[model samples]
Target: MAATLTRPKLDVKSLDPYTFLAVIGKRVIHPGGRRSTEELFSLAALQAGQKALDVGCGVATTAIQMARRFRVAVTAVDISPLMLERARSNVRRAGLERDIEVEQGDILGLRFPDGRFDRVIAEAVTMFVDRQRAARELVRVCRPGGMVLATEFFWRQPPTDEAREIFLGQVCPGMQLDQLDGWVRIYQDAGLSAIEVRSGPFEMMTPRGFLQDEGLVNAFACMVRGLSHAAYVRKMAWLMPRISRAVPYLGYILVRGVKPAAR
Candidate 1:
């Protein structure tokens, strides 16, 4: 008799609405777009010979970009195996296998040695994990005097009930979403010094955003996916206006700090 083969079950708990966007081949899932990533990297002041780490690097888009744009070597890590697979594929496609390394990892507790990287970047993540712990980990892995930056979904102000229901409940479940000041506070509490923060709108699902992030071809693919995938299509049907209504209070923040230099 032939034995029955079993495939591993998909980890739905790891998924959020963003996973739907990724499934449809959308690479730029960051809050603002590609420009936002460039801005963050520029602010990080990444340079050649710098060793960087991208924590929770979904699909490794930023990792590849930083390696190519700044001539830096990056170790990209994500908790989700599915994301790591896609990220590895993207890295290979970019011909950046030499410059970028992909690893499966947990953000709350990383395996790298202390003071390992020149730059540590956690983008659009940490909202789901313990912000304080994640920040500490990021700073821990970063060399003293190195830059550590995290970009997360930030409430422009306190969330109204309806907005909370949509953002915290629907958009990002089981997440610890915070307001602008609250996000900044996480780094302060983590003992990072020389903190700098920048805020902007989360117009990521809009047309202009698509162009800015994915460009013409991939944006077209995303549009097609929005039409073809039932779940994504339904998500879009419900998401746009709901987020639009909440736009005034919804946005993202880029918070950067220097790991205090040794005395």
Candidate 2:
């Protein structure tokens, strides 16, 4: 078995959100579900023998899938120890120890050498950090001409002050959401080329989305676990309707940027 890449200290604040989702059997925490992920792979043309990096790769499900689907080797990194622990466990359970390596690292300051990976991916992570710096780091480690793909929650329609208050302030504080153009500007500003952004429905937390993301059995299990904790249950109840209402203004985005070949 490959040793874990690195062990970073646990951050309690980071642990809570992912742990909450994990406890409820929520493996795919990002929006857009499997469909969008597959779309990303198709757009990126994920192929055999590529070396990929999955930054902030919670639970490493996509990492493992990349290993299986395209025969790529993946380095899956997340700052959260709890997420890495489970990711490692899941990686081992799938007998993909050789294909995917789980590590604890920050996306803004990746530990890899320059131009190390053929493909770089981060889903639902740039919002939590300095997006421009993260984009630079992503481009830095990717080989020239390699593709960097990501998925994030974007503001589809401008948020009304009320929508911002209920969803942004109450449900999640310090949440950084950008419009589609803002996201495109991020990659373009980072000197990446061939920038592209595509939007998808924001059904990541809804029952229909959950069912597709977690599968029928796990989705049912997630609901059971989510309900087991009153705090979590109430948070879900409070957020779902408000999120639904905000759907007109919110959507998930799939972004692609390419590192230009060396001059």
Candidate 3:
């Protein structure tokens, strides 16, 4: 196995919310955390010897799980160099390097050929970019009759102006969220059939959720790392209050659909 990449030093002040969380050892970064991931897995019905693509694969957590638990081969991709490095490391640590390939990839323009994968998945990804274009790419790469799945943040109810500003304006600028129906429409417009959706309140950062997603040991490790440096501590201090402001109105939408088989 390749020597584990040295942990890269990051500028805590400038890092995005997800990257910052990853830097501090948070394993589950999506809006609905592990709960939505379980939903995605149940929808996938993965089988051995199948090929899967995990776009925006943060630290390869889900990729590792899919490979180990379902015995599928996973090509995991992310746009961030930092995330990719972490993903590679995690894959190696999980002893899944043979089963999971980590690489840099963009959601709007996936590098794979059309109808290349048995399943295509993106978690908490499309909302940050061109949602329609990303959805089209996901559908394009998936084999005819294959499943395409994604998780995205949505407004469970209209947010107060302050809540909206705190999340969309300050914490995650440029993230485009919509209602659950809008999400279903994006996949439908991309030509997916038999679309299905599961949704829940945003809970990744709630005390119970943090523990649930990271597990007790990992959650404690994350806390230790978060306070290991003054910069990390400061970043956590600045971020938690802002996130709390928006969590009340936010939820996650897990959407899955099948690409129609060739006529």
Best by lDDT: 3
Candidate 1 clashes between residue pairs 3 or more apart in a chain or in different chains: none
lDDT computed for candidate 3: 0.94
Q: Weakest 10 consecutive residues, lDDT, candidate 2?
A: 1-10
lDDT of 2 at 244: 76
1-263: candidate 2 lDDT, tens digit per residue: 12221222333233345456765568888877787788888888888999999999998889988999899999999998778988999999999999998999999898899999999999888888889999889989999999899898888788899988776776566768898888888888877898877788788776678788999888888787666655566656766687777767778999998999999
> What are the models' TM-scores?
0.91, 0.90, 0.96
By TM-score, who's the top model here? Answer: 3
Report how far off residue 33 is in candidate 1 (Å). 2.0
Candidate 1 TM-score, C-alpha based? 0.91
Candidate 3, residues 18-92: lDDT per residue as tens digits?
999999888899998999999999999999999999999998899999999999999999999999999999999
Which consecutive 10 residues in model 3 have the weakest lDDT in total? 1-10
- Of 2 and 3, the candidate ahead on lDDT is 3
Q: After superposition, how far is residue 202 of candidate 1 from its true place, in Å?
A: 1.0
Candidate 1 residues 163-260, lDDT tens each? Answer: 88887777666888787788888998887889998888877776787787888999988787567634556667777776676667777789889999
